[model samples]
Target: MAVRMEELRDHEAVRAVNRAAFGGGHGETVAELVAALRRDDPGALSLVAEEDGEVVGHIMFSRTLLDAPRELVPVQTLSPLGILPQWQGRGLGTALIRAGLDEMGERGVPLVFLEGDPRYYSRSGFEPAAGLGFRKPSLRIPDAAFQVFRLPAYETWMTGTLVYSDTFWRYDCVGLR
Candidate 1:
């Protein structure tokens, strides 16, 4: 499997993957949020996992801010990582995340935040954000699920409550209260 940055033409396919990956009742909402993020955030990154020309997974990272007492810190948030049902256990999701993080790192992004299983994300260097004085932007997200990965350029003193893009709240997606 090859992981690459999503192109303009891959929007519909990416939406389909997100919808299917989160199928029960949250599919459309998640897909809609992805679309909104793409449209609204110029710094947002969308990536797709390709296997022999078929898109098997998708992930996104959008610009966010950390509301520190003194200043706003720029960061990114990883959300809605989706892998086709059949491809779930094949490491496609991991590959997509790793590739996206590498891209963000190269772009000088200082941090990446997310709400996910610590057991899984920890493998990719994520740690509980609360331990580092990072707070969730929403009360809906429990402390345990809130995690962050500080890139090489991150400063040790950077810590505060996260502030997601308005698109996140507007779409009523995972990050909202």
Candidate 2:
């Protein structure tokens, strides 16, 4: 399948993809989070991968602040990356991630954070956030799963405790940690 990436404008399609991709007790929560982020975080970047005019995958990056003692470093975090179960292993997820990162970098985003498998995300240059003085804002997340990818505009002084938007916590999604 030829996957085309674009900003997610079809809320219904995106919701369906999220529900199917993360199906379980957590699927609806993630889908709700996407809707909440759309309303609460205007600066958030939400993209979808489409094939044959249908959304097959989705990824989101919401604007956040790293509360360093001296300054609030602006950054974004990757969350709720999803690909249809049937579409898994076809590189759609990877393509969505790469496209999101490139767009963030072009927009001058300094860093990107995510909580996921290091074995999978490491392929995209993500490294342990702790190693770079970045601390998880919540204790619920494991240190090993919390990773960061520094963009071209990243600076050494951008390290600090991450602060996510209320939408993340309200939805009780991955951002809770």
Candidate 3:
């Protein structure tokens, strides 16, 4: 499988992947969130995994603010990582994240945040954010699910509450609730 940046032609395929990965019809929220992020935040980094010309997985990282007491800092937030059901057991989701993180590090992003299952995300170097002195935007998000990955550019003073963009709140996708 080849991982590459998302393009205009990958939108529909990306949604399909999200729906398949996050079923329960709850996937609709994630699908719509990705669209809104793309529309509202053009700089959001999005990537896709393709195999045999088929889009198998998708991931997106959007800007978030760290309301630190020392100084406000800009960071990235990963969300709605989705892989086609058939590709779920494979490493597509993790690959997309590693690729995205690599790109974020290249761009000098200091931190990345996400609310996801620790069992899976831990493999990608994510740790409990609260333990690292960070706070989640919503109490609905479980402490265990609220995670952060510090890149090479990260600084000790960057710990604080993650302020998501309006699109996240508009889509009602900020937390597990």
Task: Judging by lDDT against the true structure, name the best candidate.
Answer: 3
Top candidate by TM-score:
3
Task: Write one digit per residue (lDDT tens) for candidate 3, span 1-177.
Answer: 999999999999999998888887678888988999999989999999999999999999999899999998999999879998888888898899999999999999999999999999999999999999999999989989999999999988887889999999998887776
Score each candidate by Cα lDDT: 0.89, 0.85, 0.92
lDDT tens string, model 2, 1-177?
444444546788888889998897688888899889888888788888888877888899998889887899889989979998998998888888898999999999999999888999999889999999999977888888999999999888788899877778777654333
TM-score to native of every candidate shown: 0.95, 0.93, 0.97
Question: Candidate 2, after superposition: displacement of residue 77 in Å?
Answer: 1.0
How are the candidates ranked when ordered by TM-score, highest leading? Answer: 3, 1, 2
Clashing pairs in 3: none
Q: Report the C-alpha lDDT of model 1 over 98-169, residue by residue, as the tens digit.
A: 999999999999999999989999998999999998989888887888999999889877889999888888
Where model 3 places Cα greater than 4 Å from the true spot, the runs are none
Clashing pairs in 2: none
Q: Please tell me which model should have the higher TM-score, number 2 or number 3.
A: 3
Better of 1 and 2 by lDDT: 1
Q: Distance from true position, residue 177, model 2, in Å?
A: 9.0
